[model samples]
Target: MRVHIILAAVFWCGFVDSRKIRGISSSYKRFYRERKSFLCIDGSKILPFEQVNDDYCDCEDGSDEPGTSACPRGRFYCTNLGFRPHYIPSSRVNDGICDCCDASDEYNSHAHCQNTCWNLGQRERAYVEGQMRTLDEGLRLKQQLIEEGVLLWREKQAQLRELQQVAEDLQIKLEEHRRRKNEADRLKEQTLKALEAGDSGLIRQNSTVTSVFQLLDSNKDGSITVDELQARVALIHDEERVLSEDEAVALLGGGHQMELTKFRHTLWDILTKGDSVKIKDTLGAPDSLGGEDPHLKAADRAAKWEATNLKKVEEAYDTVNMEISDLQKKLTIDYGTDWEFLFLNNQCYKLKVYEYTYTLCPFNQVTQKNTAGTEVSLGHFFCIVCQTLTRRTVCVLGGCGP
Candidate 1:
């Protein structure tokens, strides 16, 4: 009877311990009452939470009672079987850590755990350091380029200053040249006026001789006819001479022509031989009678004056044109050979002319393929001398396509 009681007590204690290990309780029963749910472990479905912790896998995803350690191929609890317990990435759950090579990490009651997680951490650190080194090298090159750009800017500033100074000096020199040329022009005008005054007396005497000759040839026939002689003699005397036929014949002959020529010479010598004699006669004549002489002299003087002035004006215009042409040539050389001077905004503007020619060919597809697959050929050349483009082309016969 004593052995039976002891054996019954031991069996009851084992049953109570097993019930505790499986996590079976009145609350568990109440929670799963009348509910059709499954535990996910080892790809199987089981009825209640009592079966969830029965040291068996009963859920497909091991989602049932994740806090427990009853499911295989599910979450495991390690009590550090031989080393320190440590958490790892979910992918490393069953990867067999070096510290847990005995698979003790899958047991909830185990206490020995070890960790060897330094290799992955070291690899990440090394990669980050390499990236940082590359970034530092690139930053150093960028800084060097910035320094070079600053030095180039300073050099350009110095060149600009020198150019400005040279431009100012050229302006001063141009002004001085203009002033000297104006002074020379004034002196030339004064000299021309003096030379003109010295020839005035001789001009007056020549004018009187011209007038006398013009009066002798009043009909403007280039010769003295009988009518002109009659008119002259009538002005000096009221008597008229009637010419007989024989006398008229003798006058027409060359025998009496010498006498008439001598008479004309005598009159011209009396009038124009000496300036003093001409001036004396001019002063002695009545003011009303000689009024015509002064008017004629004034007209002659004006004509001579206009001729001299016209000559000077022409000379000045030629000088100005020559200087302008020289300046244009110099400007073309300084700027570029293709540079042209255009008048705009009341000033001369230098402009460059660029000329080129491109040829377009209209041909059929077959011909285009035969002609190196080219639709257009450009034969381009620039003439710096004349700044022009010359293009020539031969038309393809019957090759154009619609």
Candidate 2:
């Protein structure tokens, strides 16, 4: 009795599983009823169930003959069990060539088709798995780069802040130094005018002569010696070389030194009227003014020192300003939406064409060099645009050619 029951269950399962209509996928099996009449798939007509796969055209829309090529526009399904299910044109059915991998299309033909769907499916699965692994690795690397880029961006911002602070400090110092220099100059001018106006015949000379005398007489011994002239001025002779000691003495009225009165009568006139001497007071010399009023001498020295300090401060301020400008420009660049491409900033790539080598500097410019070493700029990086269909981005270069 148990053996009979098992036999009956196996038969029933087989019958139920084999109830699918010919050339119809399992999803459409409900429409292919086992009853007497068959309704066209488009509901355009009703036909007898025997005409479903008959070798005769029945319905105008070819819906009643999907399993055969009876209708020119009909479609035949290939239930490729081990791979993908598909449909082929009805004209290709039983045409000698095996259009379906399972040989279902050539059911009544002599042509043979092999079941290669399983092998094709295996290869497709492996390809998809490889692509997934590659995508995972690419995403991981992208995340790492983005992190690194963020750190780099923060570092740059820190540098910018530090530079901005330095520039601000330098500006303040520059202003202070400028004020000190101006005050010193005003005091020195007032003192020199008072000394020149006094009846002390020691400096009964013009303001220009008096100023020249004070600069040259760094030791303030009431006279300017050859050593003092050489130390105080870069006396260019003949517009090409330094003036010799003899030349200095000749200009100083045939003596090695000249008092203020003789200097006015000789060197001052020559300096102002002739090109025999060029006196550029390169003033950074030590002075001990024993013959002049201590206050006046102190004022002159203070003015010279302040002027030198102001120059140094100006130079430092300029340097800081330039650095700030450069940092601002770098910070304003567009790295990426998430700063992902920041790692490529200032990085360069190269490619060689037939007769030229092209260099691409990210966020900078593109240039090409020929075999002869002549380089031409292609363009500068302008913007980036994403192509929707391609799902990729392209950089747009501008300002030159392309």
Candidate 2 Cα lDDT to native: 0.73
Q: Which residue pairs clash in candidate 2?
A: none
Tens digits of per-residue lDDT, candidate 2, 143-178, equal 998999899999989998998898889889888878
TM-score of 2: 0.66
RMSD of 1: 27.7
In candidate 2, stretches whose alpha carbon ends up further than 4 angstroms from where it belongs are 1-20, 199-285, 291-297, 383-402
Q: Model 1: what TM-score? A: 0.24
**Predicted candidate 1 versus true structure: per-residue lDDT over 124-169, tens digit per residue:** 5688789999999987866665565455445545655654555456
What would the TM-scores of all predictions be?
0.24, 0.66
